[model samples]
Target: MNDKVGIVIVSHSPDVAKGAADMVRQMVGNEVPLAFTGGDPGGGLGTSVETILAAIDRAWSEKGVAILVDLGGAETNSEMAIEMLPEDRQGRVVVCNAPIVEGAVMAATEAWGGATLDEVRRTAEELSPA
Candidate 1:
């Protein structure tokens, strides 16, 4: 199996996160590790550190993980989750600043192609508006 950079999708809405992940799978297949988190543990529409952490674990890889978040709150919570990881993992994970859906799709595509973390991040970030 290929050990491409992993990916995590974060959103305030669970449905949105799941849909983005689904799109990634359809577009890139499952060669790259992938996970997603959204909403609070209480089932409300908000970001959650716990859920984000869990998603990170699910998508963890020595190749590292690239996170795509849907909103400010999701990004903030994703940062918190990254801080909570071990030092080794902390350094490898990155939160990409790009559109959640499009970014995730492109990020996964890069990862599946064996791109490095930075390359995958750039692939997603390039999707952003100038």
Candidate 2:
């Protein structure tokens, strides 16, 4: 089977992250690799670089990985997570600046369609809340 790009969702609320993941799964079925990290390590309203790193690892694919963050520190933590990856692999990951829910859906669908990492990221970025 051809390896497809994977998706990671980051959010300040665990429920938001998980809910968005579920929606993406419904949209893409089992064909896409999907993972999510939300809330703090202590189960509070925040994000952790470690958790984001683990989620990225879970969604890792040779094709590449795209990450969508909800808000606030999620973007920062996601960037840190990507930076934590080895230099060789860091370029394989992208943190998208799209709304988490919409971006996750678009990214997962693009991945399910076997799009390249850059393709998936572009698809997600094309989505506008306006």
Candidate 3:
């Protein structure tokens, strides 16, 4: 596992993804690397598959990257993004189970240095509101 962990949140709109990232930063103090994808000017509505993949590449450049996505188009975008990663790095990317807000917070706050994907996943699930 990589010591540096990255977060990628995808949603139907940039605001949703960025909002999720913002929430995580609020808890974790912006120490962790996080990226936003899904929407932007001229980027079209719904999840941005290419944009998400690009963000993942950048995030993974520094460390491992995990992905969390909103429902519908975001889910499809995430899946496509995962497929785009190199085989070895693919395992480092995860689609979180919890909602974007809770999942991003759990992934960011709980992802200590050297934390594995399993640990991150567990934390996200554990921290998610029931």
- Top lDDT hit: 1
Better of 2 and 3 by lDDT: 2
| lDDT tens digits, residue span 1-130, model 2 | 4399989999999999999999998877978888998999887999999989999888889898999998879998889888999988899999887989999999888898889999999999999654
Candidate with better TM-score, 1 vs 3: 1
User: Which candidate has the highest TM-score of all?
Assistant: 1
Give the worst 10-residue stretch by lDDT in candidate 1.
1-10
Per-residue CA lDDT of model 3 for 1-130, tens digit only, reads: 3365788888888778778878877878666777887674486668766788888876673446778877877877788878887798887788887788888887877675546667777777775667
The estimated TM-scores of all candidates read 0.97, 0.95, 0.85
The global C-alpha lDDT for each of the candidates, from Candidate 1 onward, is 0.92, 0.90, 0.75
Candidate 3 collision pairs: none
Candidate 1: which stretches are off by over 4 Å? none
Model 1 agreement with the true structure over 38-115: per-residue lDDT tens digits: 888889999999889999999888889999998899999999989999888899999999999999999999998889
Candidate 3 segments exceeding 4 Å error? 40-44, 61-63, 127-130
Worst 10 residues of 3 by lDDT: 57-66
Candidate 2 Cα misplacement greater than 4 A, ranges: none
